[model samples]
Target: MTHEHAFSLHVPDLVFGRGALAEVGEHARALGLTRVLLVTDRTLRPLAPVTRVETALRDAGIEVILHDFVAIEPTESAIDRAGAAGQIHGIDGFISVGGGSSIDTAKGANLLVSRGGRIADFLPPPLGAGRTLGGGPLLPHIACPTTFGTAAETTGIVAFALDHGRGKTTLTGAPLRPSLGLLDPTALLTLPPMVLAANAFDLLSHAIESETARPFESRPAPADPARRPVTQGANPFASLGCREAIRLVAGALGPALDDPTDIESREQLMRAGLLAGTVFGMSGNHLPHALSYPISTLAHRWTAPDYPDDHPFLPHGLSVALAAPAVFRHLERRLPDRFAPVARALATDSVADALIALMRRAGLPNGLTAIGLSDEHHPALVEGALAQRRLIDNAPLTPTAADLAAILADARRYWS
Candidate 1:
């Protein structure tokens, strides 16, 4: 029997491939951005690629202001500081030059610059402070992704951390998407081995979660177009992206992680990340993201949280990877049929087992206990997952607290 599906997907003008960085100047000129904020971190500064990006833009006569202090897991303060810098520099456009963290920070800055208010104030909650964004006149934006995850280059979503918050929240709307996306595989060649692995894991999680999440069904009619949210239904085009994304991640992560210098692997990972981002962007994610929060927050003990969300302390991708096997098993029980595509995508006998093995091979922690979550943490984690209405609403089987508890128990066992 044939299934029917309807959809709408929005992607910025995209320039992807080798030597694509050279097109930056032309793309910027096309966007008519004279003053651009080059949002990036200090680590990328020594690379010729960073210089190349600026030079290309400069040769095109675009005035560039560099925000070099972008932290690993950006904070509310960082977003504020970046927004203030954009205002002071009179930046007319934004060009993000690093991974998910840098791109998300740039997106947050744009929201403030275009809409008006502290990034925290505009947040709706879980992370948003509930105050509306007041930045005016959205500016032209471009993303030059150097990492293989988040796909912030093309999406309208910007994940951000709130002061003293438990997890990440996002700024969503069409205006948040960049006008252009520049994905050059060459830029990703320099990623550290750990980061490369973590990012690959992130892409895998996106594909799995988006593919296996509950099927979309009709809900109460929206009050109006403005109030309508994307999650209320699923789009077919996004599902295609999800399938391709899974295939790419499974095929690419191992080679890329083991051989960071392998340019081909890096390029594949980048494309996989973009495809995964596209899928998750439209279909939205569910359980793994929710389960990842507490685990991510815990990761701050090992490294600073520099990404948009607070729990991003673990790197959004890594945290998601750590939680995937368990999440998928739970999901498979809820919707056995959904796993068919995931199994096919991963070329495994079964989706859950495929993901479990993939996670192991990727060096992702096998279970919560392996990563340091104790039994004491399970209850709070369950509560946190419960509070994630956005993700929970998308779950194939709406898990109760007991269900979450059982999954955590499984995770504990898997770790040992």
Candidate 2:
């Protein structure tokens, strides 16, 4: 099998600091945007972060069209609604000011407005029309994340749920990436403790997965260099970011959660998120993220604190955390050397044990069972995880269906 000898790193233009969000309007004008669509969720509409961005944009003489219908976890319908708003307003650009859902909603809206098709037209087969995006340059987008996890601002992927919660899928390409990412630590001040814990775990997962993903040299070279996958696997440039992110999360997550007003800890956590985000796309993720899709899609009884209570919601990070310890334990046997840096960064001999300890400290769910899954759900969980080939294939040693099933079984309960 031929292996790749080259890799590429793509990151959005970034402005990071305490008050970086206040400068978004200047950047939007620099991008030549006159009228912009501001996408956010209803829950965040009255929040300080949203108000701050709105004030900044109007202060710069930019016309803002507010679209606050974004769901907690974005869905196809939500994306279409946001897209329709953009079309109606003839928005010249997009400014997303919430979590991953809001940013991804803006991405979907931008795609529909620029490419002139439904989201399904660009999705993969069996779930979508399997069409590719070549619709010329999409409108410029500037993403401001209120949460610290998903890193939607820095990625070229848009993940959303199918209508009625059938499942989750993604639209991926360079055009989907935001033109700039505004990292403002103060945006996290309103995050609840449980939400903060989930974010920290998600940050940890990004760093570890990037650090242990299949090396670029191990992947098959693309027949066309121009078509090289956005996720190029572990490379030298990404490793630098991954290691530091792991160390920062280890030291700062606890402090930040203990005191919501601790700006210093919040700043550290935000930096950790930024570092992890910049690199994870280059390396991709592995089993835990793949497994998270099923865990979230099939959830029937779990509800998280400080989230919209209208649905049976499981925050993305918590779902990923539930599967992480089991997945990492499975990987450690095969990739002990790769996990050494992670262990050193966490100051622990066993990465899985350290994760469990952290989860306990953060008051996270005990495991999959805690979230209402049982032995009967293993088949569906395994099948769902296997369907995420993009994430599954990035593992250094890809798992077979049976391997996934066993992992699910092991993940059922981490503690009594």
Q: Which predicted model would earn the best lDDT? A: 2
Please tell me which predicted candidate would have the highest TM-score against the true structure: 2
> Which 10 successive residues of model 1 have the least lDDT summed?
303-312
TM-score of each: 0.91, 0.98
Q: Which ten residues in a row have the lowest lDDT in candidate 2?
A: 128-137
List, residue by residue over 1-416, the lDDT tens digit for candidate 2: 78899998888998999999999889988999899999999889999999999999999999999999999888999999999899999999999999899999999999998877788878877787888888367999999998888989999989888987688877788889999999999999989999889989998999999999999998898999878888989988898999999999999988988898999999999999999999997789989999999999988689987777897888899999999999999989788999998899999999999999999899998888898999898899999999998998899998999888888888888877
User: Can you write out model 1's per-residue Cα lDDT over 1-416, one digit (the tens) per residue?
Assistant: 32323344667788889998888999889888899999998888778678989999999998999998787767788889999999888888999888877888888899888877788777665455787543244788888888877778877777765567556666666667778888999998878766777777777777777776665543444445454454533456677888888888788777876776888878877888878776677677888888876667655554422333443256777777767777778767767777877888888866767766766675666666666678998898888778777888877778899998888777774533
Cα lDDT of candidate 2 equals 0.90
**Global lDDT of each model?**
0.75, 0.90
Q: How many residue pairs clash in each candidate?
A: 15, 0
TM-score of 2: 0.98
Clashes of 2: 0
lDDT of 2 at 26: 90
